[model samples]
Target chain A: MTSDRFDLGGGEPIITLRDIAKSYWRETLEIPVLQGIDLEIPAGAYIALMGPSGSGKTTLLNLIAGIDRPTGGSLEVCGHELNGLDDDQLASWRNLHVGFIFQNYNLVPVLNAFENVELPLLITGASRGERRDRVEQALALVNLEDKMKNYPRQLSGGQEQRVAIARAIVTDPDLLVADEPTGALDAKNAEEVLGLMERLNAEFGKTIVMVTHDPKAAHHAKHQIHLEKGVLDKAVEVNR
Target chain B: MRWLALIWKSLMRSKRRTLLIVGSLVLSVFTVAVLQSLLTTLNAVTNNPNSSNRLVVRHKSGLTQMLPRSYEAYLRQQPEIETVCALQWFGGYYQDPRNFFANFASDETTLFQIFREEFGASGISEAQIKEYLRDGAGCIVGESLARKNGWKVGDVVPLTGTIFPINPRLTIRLIFKSPKPSDENALHFHYKVLEEGVPYMKGLSGSFWVRAHRPEDIPRLIERVDRHYANSAYETLTETENAFNLAFVKMLGNIGAIIQGITAAVVVAILIVTGNTMATAIRERTTEIAVFRAMGFSAGRVLVLLLSEGVLLVGVGGFLGVLLVNLAAGGVRSSLGMAMPFFADFAILPDTILACLAGALAIGLLATFVPAYAATRRPITEGLKAVG
Candidate 1:
């Protein structure tokens, strides 16, 4: 039921968080993950969440991706209040609106590149021909159309990451969230992935939120936000 | 439908684990099918379709005690009794104790009329039946028994008696074949040879087999004969041929109970092995499952995928196991037909195969439910953090 209720319309912020807090429990003790966080990411804006390891940058990114719920405060992603939806509803929301890229390039080992890219589309009611065309187009956009039949182990770190990127953008999602997309890659491969992400943001106008500690990786985005100890340190807009 | 391919690929991820679990399931189901089918074949003898209008009169106490031979003439006086035959158990062995079969001393003149349903059919010719009736020292042996000992119609067969007093060397005048396998492994001789050989057996025989005029006359004839001999020196217990065969099965000491116990044990063993393997498999795929949940697959979908793996594994195994039973049935029929007196046919029933398949499916589902549900119920964030 796509209705006016879910319509924040064009040029609106895709993600808006206010006083968001997440915590864990160790018996009776409370371990706070992210507290008193306020952030907004607009449509077609590329941003990086930069922080130390335990700064909860990944947790914050996960919340924005609708993968986790904030224990307190409000979270709105793609015009849907995530806290208002159940776990199942949030999952559907993620499938439609957000694409995920993980640090290790979490492609299913058994599925080849083409099948891996076709996973999200399988959830949709898209016909087989449509899914096939879209998968081929996604792989061609990532410049790995030739490696569509290769399993994950048959490809190198950079090739695997490219296949993962194809999988991420195959759904043509409004938002792409990468949690250290290049952390497991070497210098050359990391440079290739960073360039590809920049091309996706600049050429396609696809929004991206990346979590990484590497300044080199962070520089791929138009805006950089540093988080320290479950708190937002600063947000800076980069030129070029 | 594409999910089916995913399930297949996921199950094939660990080939050694899948093979091991499937192998265990096949072994257990094979053993269960064979055992239960044997029990079913044995139980089927009670209502043997070939035993027509026949009643066996034994001692009121038990089969071992001798009955008066004069009861045959008294039974012949009854209007319902069409014919009577003296059937004394000749517990005999041909060459070895392992080479066992049914050998009885029956009234040669009336034996054909009494058991014509089993013998006078297409398997044995009328000429062979005449040859058996003509010679006093003649014997009728089933075709399977002849093949085992390599005896032809003119061969002189000597069987050393275990329970009776003497050994009888007689010509195998007739080699008869029967439709039933157990019925084909038998030897019947004249009761006079047995009585004349043993002095005390002259006036006493083991039992009497009486054929009535009609199938409906059996119950009334049984009541009449037993009541007539109720307080006599050789008091008789008379019953239908089905009940008579059932008594022999009962003498084997609760075979149905034993079969059920073994089947239950085998099923439990399969459940334990398959359940443990499924638990380990599900544990290893925790992160993958969490990924599916994150990708909008509901918990029920994941459960279906996981449980389908178990079914595909065990269901294929059970099918192969039941197929093995069918393949080996001929050999089983021959071998066990030689060993057991009541096992006429060893076959895998359609019901048995269906039962095996249903049982395997049930075991697969029951084994995977706890593990699949457990994997699905864990928080997606926690599962996503699992490394292996």
Candidate 2:
């Protein structure tokens, strides 16, 4: 544990983990999901987590996204320690500092692409004008400005994923967490979505943590961390 | 606002299911409306104080017992009793047994005076009334029955008696149109004619109708009349006409209770069916609800969406039912044929519609409790995992 205090002198690490572990109870048997993990990522860092199935890559991404709490660990994101926060506080914190992109492109089926992308701004107390401007800018970054009014079902797989990416950066959060962002797409669509993520990282300086097992998807990130058996194996820095 | 749009889209997703639920609500509310109208009309006819002015004096034992015809003269002697007439229920039928109508034999002289508002020939002169009174075998029939039987003035009408035991043939000298159409149709003739025609009914009258000096003094006058005949050979039981009419309705037992029970059952059944439909709707929209919650909608916002859908369905249904009931009021009154009065007054329409809306809102709240809680309680991680 890091004394339960933010090290503001070090300019606040975007994410900090110390001995993080998570377990599930299945019929009275303890199923350890993540065991004794320690890591840190600074602001404006694009990090990719790669691992085989059942290797806790998605679990780690969830912890970083503030959507799940670790059973035993000291975890901090955006200068807030998340160990003692209640569910509502965590939700509020996620709304303010985190944006997520799911592999399935979890856009609300009923709303148009612009509305889905603008959702994160609703909880931030932003004015309507500010929300509209930011949502439009984000959509234009993903080259989806023309398809803003189209629903998720009307868009192609590549377009839906691009809308999801636009949603992730619309809030201008300090951290973006995407789990298997390209897992459900064909090769052509996946490459298009990867190109959009790379553009978001380079053009906007967004600190992103993407979990994917595909090497081609990992190549879009500046750094990749592999996980094996609930432990971080190694890290590799990739060039554009 | 965003959440509301989402809910509207989700409700529109299955048009057939939504229509089915709404149709069921319409049917339930329609039935409730019609039943309430029937009860209201029956209550109005039986309890309207303005229409009931004829006091009924029967035997102290019961209506089955008869009073001597001589008591009619004795009753007329009292200054408070303005005019006296006797009526014996001649449970008679016309061409078909199902063509039921009220038949009574009364003194023609006072029949017109006592029931002046209910019975009067629209165009006939007083001389005709005097002539009809002079002729012992002359009769007066209601316009409805006259039209049904195709009997006009001066036409002979034949009626078979079930209680008096003889078929009576009389000439209708006058056709009385009801001054108030809401009043029951009655067939009236001379008591002397009936007595002369049937030898066993020589000195007997079933009940007496007395006109009081003041309507408010009816209760005191009834006590006075009963006291005067307290020890007579055939004791008299006197009551206001409204009370007398209500006694027949009361014979069916607590009608109000029966109606309340039936209405309650109908409401409960509707609630259950509607609740089931709403529960299924919420269950099927679990993923969408999660999407809303993740989009920064509060738990209360989701609840409002569900409740709004319910109100829309039930409120529209209730309004349609009210319109249908109002449209059918005249047909129901004519079909009931003197059994029920025309009940056009829907004073409780607003409250009934509100009750239906409240019932729907309650169903919405109850059905969505589990799903709303589940969605709000879900980890965003799990909710996002629901994709694909």
Candidate 3:
């Protein structure tokens, strides 16, 4: 394992963070969650964020995904400076550039797998045929094309997570931010999900940033960035 | 339109909750529709177009008061009057008191002449009129009344009078149909039956119905008749037939206001109920809403989706309510017509139906707006942490 300053050295970075700070105000009390974070993640690099609880790992991921606006400093993801964009503009930018995978699988219970995967495309003004093709391709890549009509309730934990992955990748976004992606799955299902993530990173050249506490989950990434008390340490390259 | 499936599925997410809210809306909308239609039906009585050329002459004191039978002769003497018929309320029932209906004793000689548009317009032959006048104990019934009582021509209808205390066994000489439903739910017999059966009522009448020669003659005839008997012992109150019907409606004392007030109250109740229900439903979907927001659904778009779900719910309920009222209108008309002559044509007007649906949509938008907007405004991260 080799540790270095937080930069993957080859192509232009897809995500650039500079002196990023985020704080939530609970009434009059300002609670700082992340402060003065600076990092650059090159395109096609699969990375994991590891930290103890309350270390702002998810908060940093939220900032990178453009779901949360930083209180100070600049965030540029996929070449768009996020700090200058308004909330709705940021949402539109996220729709085009970012995809999200949540820990609990977060599949809308009322929607079947196909509809869940098709959700992100609904806002893109994509033609019906285009959306259907993209959704099918995403599901086929996740190897769950046969379960397109099954609802989340009918799916196993592993299947639901795979469907979530399908949903995240359906739009073919530039960045994928996942928070605790395998937190709820059993060990076998977790291994399967991590293998799928490896395939997404290696075969599809997708830039993946996932937050997890498990060491084995972090090992699936090419590099692991650790955060403690809103500060980022050096990145460690995981040797095969 | 593309989001319709999502909205529909979300609304149907909790089938029991959605159904309960829809049931409440259906009941609320049904109540308002029926009450408004009843008010419209009552108003139609005073706006009847056929009554424009007719005048009613009643005792000056009130409707229940009696005028001298000689007033008919004076009414006929007016140059503007084309025909006159003296009528007395013979409030009667059939075999049972529960079968009560409006029955009147009227001058048979000029009955058809005064109501030619009502009785003759529907193709009643001259022979039928003559037969009714020729028989001493004969009556003319509206087609609906005859059908309701299973009576045909030459059938004997024994009406026991409540006010005059007399039983008149009269043959149905003519069964006439009128365009107005109210007119078709009444029975009219020869006034001579009461005149001879009860001697004291020989020279008294409840009212006189006068037909003017032309529509323009009604106003002048009304003025002239009231002026002629202004200070007499049996002073007369003359008005157009519409005003006469309106006077009866006015006797109910601000009934329209009462219905409107109740309707408004019901609408507010629906809003509160539906608002509370939508709030609960949205609260339960906090994580899902956050998931949608995280998936790049803008706040405004999500709000619209939730509102569409609410409106579709109430819209369906309102449509069913209006449909139910329309389906049951005939039975309601028949039952009310037997009890009150003014409600004989009870119907839910199209305008009322439109108004109900519009009101439902407005309520849907209103009831769901606050909760859905608040849900959208919530921090996506905070919402994502919410449990089911």
Candidate 4:
């Protein structure tokens, strides 16, 4: 691991960040979001990113997910040097290795549950029969097989999140990056969604990186990484 | 191909908006189709294949000025001329002015011979032609006119003259059918009837219809006949029947340019309307587009999906517009056929239909490309931040 990196003491590292810096520009003004960040996340580890508003947690998450690029630094994910890939290459790389879950459960309103979950496989050139079998399996894993034909508006918040989870994992991606997975859910639904994520990590051996503000939600992760003012502050292992 | 469903669903996301765009496209396409078909029908009158060997000898001033009947003898003297027949526009209506149609007075013996194509073996029988020639008060009407007025052989038809002062009661000796519907809406009678009815009309004819023995001989005959009577009191403007028919079309005053201008305006309007609609739709789906991009869809792929949706929408509308116009063609022909004989055979040609469809699709691609490409080019993070 790099000198400033956190060695999580899990399996081999699947994501490595070194001297990562990101900044946004509002015309002539340049505002820094993340600065001097070094981190290594081991394979199959569930890590939670906890920070206050505008703490750059989401920006860091975006960089690691290959959806955003750092102004200065080298980043690697799933054995691919993300810093070296162009925008299209990064997109293809993401399709192969990363899954994203947004806080708002950004499901395409026109597509039903089945089609939503089947979206990733479409770009992969999967056959119709293969797509059907895999979509059914993913929906079943989320316990939403019965609601396959329901549109996003027809489902409750928790069910919608589950459907989003099904879409995230349908391609068997190497990493799942979620932003406030339980932000919009009630206590019972949030608990149910956290339990599902826990099952995905412990049972399916999926590596997950999640960002949340709620302490209870963070406790569900195997480890908690905190950021303050765009800098990594500390890393702590959960007792559970 | 798999993306087609997603594209279709996205179009249906806002059903009302999609329907409104389609409705606008239909109106635009319909207007263009009708205008284009009018131009095509008008062009057909000037390009009638059967009139290739025929020529008209009208007064140099205009159709209103009468030509001397002696011009037929001079026209027949040319070796190129196979038949020469004196014709005058009777300008008469049957029973009432509202029941108007084309009625011409012509030389009886040479009338059928000059327009053999219209009264050939496929049209009136030989016996019917002979019977009509034997009767001075006999008149021959097209089958469509006979059908309209419910007249058959032996019916005494009375026409009230409009330009002339002679009202002649004539017996229908024969009914003939021509290939062109416009040709099938005219009535022809013996010019002698007009001469005997009005003494002042004795030696004057509206024009002489001349048939050349060979198609190649017509151009030379036109030049010869016009040069023969140039600068005379009754100077002649001799032209092929096609050019003669075009003279009437020219009365409409730059109709082709007018139709083309209207078509261009409609096309531009449709492009603006469709483009604005597509931009609005893309704006509303900014987040959804960002979601697709984040799911690993390339910018190019997303653009293609949006473009497909646009093309499909306009394509459906264009097809319906073409279909609606085609179905209404018969009614339009019959209605306009009564007022203008040229529109009796008006139709939407296959080439025009294809051209309209192609134009609609091109508009679709152009209108959607700018907005869709812009949507795809936007930063994924910015798009993600957008609510709708």
Candidate 5:
């Protein structure tokens, strides 16, 4: 439960966006997904993004994670301007500083829990011993140390989500970006993943940004921001 | 290095698909290896590196027509021609048609002198050569031919003739070894047995073999020997031993073109099968590919991993297939001898094996290129929406 990792320092903006806009093309017509998204999230802050479908909450999450680039505005995550980085540089930036958790668990079907969690570390060129130690530590954090050898197909929905969470946090990323992390899980499993993610933010002082439709899932974060049709709603602070 | 494990695991995700692709690749490469090695073995017949100093004088029209045995007398008078021997093809069978091999009727006294480099320089003793000439009915058999049948030295070999109307039962006077395997599958008997037994072959031969004093003098001697009989009743066609062997291969029809066509078809088949397999595998893993990209694995890295999977699959399969061909060399040689008498030992050459492996790897790389690139270039947000 204790994080003896590098301190990202207090009150510094981990993610900064200025009038960010993302648009795509449907053949000849221009379709806009996100528009004028100006926001700042402080270091070590836990936030949830809430919106209906096509509200561009996941798009904004992707922009912040450096998985997608803004077409019209400045995006800075963990001190690097994501819009200015090339595809390869954006990948390295994401690998080093941004962690991701998906609704489908996204654990490589062939890899067991330990190997899946060790993926981002491999991108950092970490030695095998270092990777093993870090993987063990991360699995233990998620309470899945006993299931480290189980593949995704062999695990339950809850165990798979927890393993995905372990994978997202194993690299000690500066920002954890999760899109509906517990969307596929049952009620009990959803509560457990939310609790683990909350503990990661509160006890380890890790920064997290999650997108969810469930109000209960949003409440686990310290702050909740809503989007309506590519526009932001007022941010709400939650007293947990 | 770390991605190796990932690549391997990804390939094994659908074991049946991977195995099918590998099986197809192995079979294709094995066929290609066999065909190319057969071509190589045939070429090895004409490319006798040790017999460059020898020349053969045959009928100008083709090997079917006979040359005058008097040509051997004229060829022996030349200073450049160290020794000359008349050789006639004795197409015959042993106990069964399946036991077919090369049996030549040649000058018993001078055959040893003309083929001194192939025999005398090896380990054939003076006594064996003298004994072969001492008996007109004696024949010198190649060691392999003798070993294949139970025809040891002093054993009488009864041959049923097919080309000439004479059944010559001759004693095995010597069993000589040659540096070349093709040369070790022939038997040579005294020319007198062939001449006296047949009416038309009294003063005719299939060809006149002349060993030059030096290899460098062969070109001039070839010109001299041909010009000597430029306008005779049966004109002479003189050439090096390599050309003579190549003429026989050429008569067997377009083997080179056939081999090339077969290899080309094999390459195409492998590419199509492997490409389809890779495309399907990548299509099944769209979301996983996006996940890797989102985890900071670059597009290039994704392609490299996928390409490695394909290449390694074919590489491993192709190598095993080639190894199987190598193991079946003995059987292939025995089977091919009935149709292609020049197949020698029928084993795959080192260069041909390397080519098959390289070809398999090339197929692997090409087969996955489009699929891997397409997967890596898929939009991340769109890809994340994929169900599985």
Candidate 6:
């Protein structure tokens, strides 16, 4: 077996992990969430992570999204070592390279769909015309061009999640991490959202890493990795 | 643009709360603007250079202490003093005690000479002045007092004296047309009329009103006049018209400071209320702020958006208050009459507006710090997890 500190190349692997460990402190006791995780995600590869409730799936997703730091291992995403980065640097990196989607579809209620999609583009020093163009393209991609001016209160649950997705991908980040993107939706709406994510991965050659408890959602991805009790158990390849 | 949209949305979130805060601000600012305007007008009237040309010389002991009639003759001899008149304060009341006015008894021969600008032949003929001076019991009432008492030019009205302990017997001889708009509330009568009726007035006089060639020469001329009688039995106090008016106002003690303190308290209270409102709004929009941060907005931009909204709200309120004050200025002056100066200076409104804007912005920035920081520091995963 290879050592956990495997490095793919000098600059190719978009994400690299070496014996990453994470824990939650509850009073004096240390409750370990993730233990000894080693991972490598290449550029433009779709990855699906599947696990049960206590499998540290969310914690791993948090680490990959740059929302939390690993405890005992090195994590490198987009050729930047996240272990040594401060909170500000991590936030900047996340803005530049990482996009996040959650089950609840956290959207600003005050802004219309178009403005919401344009939010991430504001921090990138993009010109106003470029921002507008990208926002239009994103809204069009989700087939929400007609509802661009509608506020979140005027949209349905599925449409809101689609808007959130548009906001995430508008900046064209290197990695799109979604934690249960369809958890709040009904079967039909869930299928529609999943279809959109699958199309984005296939048509744009975008890399997507999704954590889900649904087997059907995992079937849509090219590679699926299962975690059980803070450890990777198996990897499966699926033909879409 | 993004920040503006965010602020707009946040304000729109609760229409009732926004309206309440803005409404209260408008009312409070309006009241303050009106009060400040009146105070400014009164202060200007008393401090104006034109208003200081006149002077009042009374007994050194007190205004009630009478001066010798010879003092007036002595003052008239000074070349620096152009004219001198004996003015006796006749403490009297109209039919109703509330209908108060200034009634003064002055030497008829020199009264018109000293107040030539206030009454001229166009309003009161020189023949009538001669006739009033010849008649020892003759009196001239101001137009405002005449109007208030409904006394015509030839009408005779009785006045009761409170200080001289005389029988309730006096009459209005003629009504002098008011020269300036502000001088319509005075009553002037011949001091010789009082001297003839009161038994104790053989050598007693009230005070002297002096007119000087140049306002600047008043102090030196007054020193010369006072030095002439320094060792005499009756010592005198000489003061400019403005100083005399200010001394009377000062008797009330620090009215300006009291008004300033009240104004300061109001401003502080407004800041606290506005700050609390902004804080609550920011807290309610915490998740939305995080969403903006996730979308690439900096914390500074968020703060600017919130602060701009606050300034806008205060600007609107302040403007409304100024408009109201300007509209009511005329009515305020007419109603206050001579008690207070009517229209105050409108120049101060701009500074007040700027102050309100700064105050609003300060509250907004202070309120925004915590929420903006919280949003900036929020984990993208956790923020996305928030349901609302």
lDDT of 5 by residue, A1-240 (tens): 111221223498888889999998889999999898888889889988999999999989988998887789998889998877899998898898988989989899899999999988887989999999999999999999999999999999999999999999899988899999888989999999999999999888789999999999998988888888997866777766
What DockQ does each candidate score versus the true complex, computed on alpha carbons?
0.48, 0.29, 0.62, 0.65, 0.65, 0.33
The C-alpha stretches of model 4 lying farther than 4 A from their native spots are A1-5, B121-123
- Write candidate 1's Cα lDDT for B76-149 as tens digits: 99999899998988988887877889999999989888888777654666677788888878898988788879
Query: In model 3, what lDDT does residue A89 have?
Result: 89
Model 6, B181-243: lDDT tens digits are 455566667776677678787668778888887788888977887787787899888888777
CA RMSD of all predictions? 4.5, 5.8, 2.0, 2.3, 4.0, 5.8
True contacts kept of 4: 0.63
lDDT tens readout by residue for model 3, A1-240: 656577565788999999999999999999999989999999999999989999999999989998788899998999999988887888788888888998999999999999999999999999999999999999999899999999999999999999999999998998899888899999999999999999988888899999999999999999999998998876888888
lDDT of 3 at A220: 96
Return the lDDT, model 3, position B370.
98
| Residue pair clashes in candidate 6 | A119-B295, A120-B295
lDDT of each: 0.86, 0.75, 0.90, 0.91, 0.87, 0.73
TM values, all candidates: 0.90, 0.76, 0.96, 0.95, 0.94, 0.76
What DockQ number belongs to candidate 6?
Answer: 0.33
Candidate 4 matches the true fold with a TM-score of: 0.95
| Superior candidate under TM-score, 4 versus 6 | 4
Error of 1 at B94 (Å): 4.5
User: Which is the winner by DockQ between candidate 2 and candidate 4?
Assistant: 4
lDDT of 4 by residue, B192-252 (tens): 9998998888999889999999999988998898899998999999898999999889988
lDDT of 1 by residue, A218-238 (tens): 877777887889988777666
Residue pairs with backbone overlap in model 1: none
